[model samples]
Target: MSHTFDDQTHGADITRLFPEQATDTRSHPSRPKRGDLAASTADALAAAGAATLICTGHCKSEIQHVIDHISRKYKKVNMVFVTADTSSLASFHEAGRTIKKMGLQIDGFIGFPSVMAVPWEMTGDGHESHFQRNYLCYFLLVNILLDDMVHGSRVVLVTSCVRTEAPAPTWVDVRFSNGEDYHCLEGYSQSMLAMILFAKSLSKMCGDRSIAAFSANPGNTKTNVQTYISMDQMESWLERKRIEGEEIPVSLQQTPKSLAQGSATILRGLLDPDLQEESGAFLNHCQALKLPHLDFPAGEESAQALWRRSQEFLGAFL
Candidate 1:
């Protein structure tokens, strides 16, 4: 059966609400709503002669296309692309060194680099791929660059609605060993759930430094993140959810969002001044959601435990 997690309609049109906030709406007629928030903010940073850092994993060429377009259209904002293989912890350290070498103090950071529904595998660092890439890499990168981020800088972790569908994680067996019992969705969902918990913990950990962290669910938008999942796997997973009586929310299954629509919520979390005090909040549909019905241990203690466990996992770097 399907469930509605919030009163706000799922996949509601949010990109157009802040038309005035868009920076290049006239150029791209089909651009996602509020998609220009980043451009607008980048413009402001450019005006002040500040540098903004954007990181990508495998989609280098496509992002370069957008960067080139932005560079040509908006003379004020200068965008630079960095490549980091998140599957390896050393790559994150190297990324930190590279960014530090550039001498840029980050003003805004959006951590949306993730993998979804891939087969159960381990990174070179000996951790599950999803846990290492989706969650741990973000944790390490932010911590590595934490001191360089100016006060009041925002960090946004792009989570998903599937986080609500995660089974309560067995922290003792956090990696969900690559044995026969493993399902790809479990690791993906665990990483998603960990992102939220890490955001909450990060907010508290960085509260005194004036750094705010948030986890955002960018409704359902098809992106290259789904490239690895086969049709057969998805069908089997859905059927299993049915037979096992799992809570499949209609919002996640209902509408396929445009790129701009999918990014609207993450942009809100990044650029919305009103959410300054709402750090560690879970944002969906451009609104912060209170998911009291989540059947998992996503509380302060769990956040702390996850933090310590992550620190242990990456102890060599930290």
Candidate 2:
């Protein structure tokens, strides 16, 4: 909940980051709807010869809208949604049931049977009980997807952002499968780090042409996720909200954009021709963002370490 980035480091050069231009400019003519975006993206990917489309999260209606548009326009592009709930196992199971009932054939799945306690247990003890349940879901979801990497599929992992400088006001002494006890918000950081590592590993294991992995931050948008916060916290957030506040620039938040608009960047990454050769890079708003250079370099070694630990923790189900 803390919006402070006071202690965070920002060395990524923003000037070098730019979104890829759409091939057919008219199809995407400025802030298109979910359907139009999907149609344009599907067309682009088809033109580029992409085999399948994989999308994450609970935006089924939006995803379906886009697919329907694509089918109408292109006639023959396959798409699938791997519904996942990072919140709890119960939620994920429920989603699975829904997907099954709808009779949609999901080619692959990456989800938890229960929520992870790593982030909560590593955030520090004697804080709010709810914080443990809240942030831990993100870790659970990412771990699920990483465990289910197929050799020849395009994988997309979606996660929310936890401000780097915020105090992880929960428990802070949990041991991961690697036998390391992390402190502060290290669990959240580890999850993000693990995501990149997993992607890098998958790329290498599959000989670069078989698989691709990428992570995306959806940015702050109006969604059902806000409902998870308590009433008191919600009121506090509203009270802290300002017409022109320091937390979020007014110009950015006030724009006529919805979550669908925010998802455009993600769509671009999955469809852009330029990205086919680009692997192991974190993307935002359809542009490659420089990750915090970790002590271990990005390659197979880091990926193996992360994969081993994740598999050990996730157990045989993955």
Best by TM-score: 1
Q: What TM-score would each prediction reach against the true structure?
A: 0.77, 0.45
lDDT of each residue in 1-318, candidate 1, tens digit only: 122233243222232333332322111101111233233333333333333435444445635555665566656554665666778788778877777687776756766646787787888898888888888988888888888787777788877775343443445677774545567876777888888877877788788987887888766666523445676776676676777887554345535556555656765665555677888888877777765433223476666677889999989998
Query: What is the C-alpha local distance difference test score of each model?
Result: 0.62, 0.39
Q: Point out where model 1 deviates above 4 Å.
A: 1-51, 58-62, 163-168, 224-232, 238-245, 249-251, 293-298
Give the clashing residue pairs of candidate 1, or none.
15-33, 15-34, 32-260
Candidate 2 per-residue C-alpha lDDT over 81-159 given as tens digits, one digit per residue, 9 for 90 to 100 = 5554343444434444444464432222221111221323422322222222332333334334333343433444443
lDDT of 1 at 282: 83
Candidate 2 structure, TM-score to reference: 0.45
